[model samples]
Target: MTYQDKVILITGASSGIGKELALLLAAEKARIILSARNEAHLLEVQAQCLSLTPHCHVLPMDITDERQVQEGAASAIAIYGRIDVLINNAGVTQRSKLIDTSPAAIRKLMEVNFFGPMMLTTALLPQFKAQQQGQIVVISSMAGLFGYPWRSGYNAAKHALQGYFETLQTEQPIPGLSTTIICPGRIHTDITYSAITGDGSAYGAMDPGQAHGIPVDVCARKIVKAMRNKKKLVLIARMEKVLLWMKRYFPPLFYFIARKGN
Candidate 1:
């Protein structure tokens, strides 16, 4: 679908994929609503978006807060009339072994990565159903598709998202309502450094896989294309894309290799 003048709300808009996506969509002439916890950073991203597009709104929101998420959804509708798209891009990653991760840390990840998006989506669903036309894009990860090492909690959260969105897609029979789940192998984002650690501290360092992953702009562009096409699941990055198909059709081999990594 065309994005011109379409209202799109993106969480985690301060930096990384969300920031890049805001810029990309703004250039497409979409009305962008930016949301994140850091008001300062939201302003920073707003400035960047305004430089690119004339229409942009900044809504400082902490997705972890259900009240704030509901309010933010209302605010976006008030500002733009209707939300054409809701991008569940706000999420946190954990980089720790299962045993190393504390119960509190696991809860924190689940709150931000799973429950936060779920709440936001539920709050917005009424609006979408009323409009009878809306798109929900989930910025999931390859970790969601397969179990990975040292990321049990993170994997669990993303996996949950995949299940939820996939089910939503199946349940939604209306041609106008849609969902897209993006499984990116790795993108050049600071997610690793910002990832929560076992001790509940930031990892504070980039991982090699993330550093060498596809560029954020490239990944965002691909996602936009997939969203417009109304794809249920889109996997970017050649290696990871291949791996996803391998895991689906060649489960035994995938499990064998995956076990070696573990």
Candidate 2:
């Protein structure tokens, strides 16, 4: 549908998929609220979005910070007193295996990828319940559907997000709220380089698959299309969906191949 007047709040809007999505929505004249930790980058994105529409606002805050999440939610709701859509796009990846991963590193990824988004979603639930209608879109990953080597923590966090949002979709007491989980396999981004390592440091190296992944704008268009359709779950990327089918229907073969993946 047309996002001409829709109030869409997006996390991690400073860069990557979130930034591209913001540009797409802004071109549609949506009232965009861009949230991220980097104030400078957020302002840069805000300027770009404003070139498309005058309804863009910048809300800089780290999703990993609970207090900031609370403040961000309050600030968002205070804008026009409604949030038609909240896109949980803020997340961090991990490049460490379970054996190599530190407990602290795992927790850090969880805080950013799973717990932070949940805190923001929980804080905004009341506003949604009061309004009687809202859409929550989660930008998850293919890893959420199946485990992979050297990404145990990232897999765990995305898996947790899938469970949490899926439960909300099925069990929410309200009648008008709907949750959509979007699983994106890969798109050219800095996520791989920024992923946390075993020692809680950035991996700082891009993966071959990510380097050759789909364009961010193409991924953003697909996401907005799915959002318009109000889909419950969407698996984007051709190769990734095929792999998911194998993982679900041919576990033995999938496992054998996954062991060889990089």
Candidate 3:
């Protein structure tokens, strides 16, 4: 279960959790492929990873674009002739209520958070099937499990993401393929700064909750451990784990608390 020499592809590798994961795996001497829309940031992360392992490569492309996803998947597989793990960590969040959010804004969130990962996973299925053993790590959110205020589109997209990947988990289309869905409550990352508003513009400000969330490096370590264990589902959270329990056993309280949440 070691990461040594394992060819792993991670999306959203420019910064935050993705970058942390890249560096962690690189330290373990894994063959790492970093992907993200920002080439400059990817290069920066690549340089850091290369210092740890010589097997680091960067493939910059927009996950929301289908052509880029397909090409990126091919390029990733061509890197080491196989991809042992694919981490679908590239996603954007929203920060507006459903009523205030425009249709296009919601669509944009769906494209990046839901369709992009699905498209990339689909494109890589053949390669995984050929290898007969591969891991698909999906970075879903706690919002995927239940409703939350000020994140209407983000909630919808994450829920859709969970549904899609969960179905794949049940279907077991690829006998040797494993899927791990990670539902993180909050990790102190700059994700809030890039969160989309009702009109599809960046929120550009960090929320109070994000400021007090778990550390990004801690979250990345937990994710890598979950991937190593091939866990079916993992929730990285504190109070949010309680909220999920409330949702399952105490619906009234769950809704009451959710209504007041940001």
RMSD of 3: 0.7
Name the runs in model 1 displaced over 4 angstroms: 173-175, 249-256, 259-262
lDDT of 1 by residue, 64-138 (tens): 998898888899899978999999999888788888999888888889889999999999998998899999999
lDDT of 1 at 192: 86
Q: lDDT by residue for model 3 over 209-232, one digit each (tens)?
A: 998999999999999999999999
Candidate with the greatest TM-score versus the true structure: 3
lDDT of 2 by residue, 1-262 (tens): 6888889999999899999999999999999999999989999999999999989899998898889999999999888679999999988888777899999999998999999889999999999999999899999999899998888889999999999999998897678988889999878888888899999999899988889998888899999999998899998886778778888899898888888775
> Whole-model lDDT, candidate 1?
0.88
TM-score per model over all chains: 0.94, 0.97, 0.99
Sorting all predicted structures by lDDT, with the top scorer first, yields 3, 2, 1
Clashes in each model (backbone N, CA, C under 3 Å)?
Answer: 0, 0, 0
lDDT of model 2 at position 210: 87
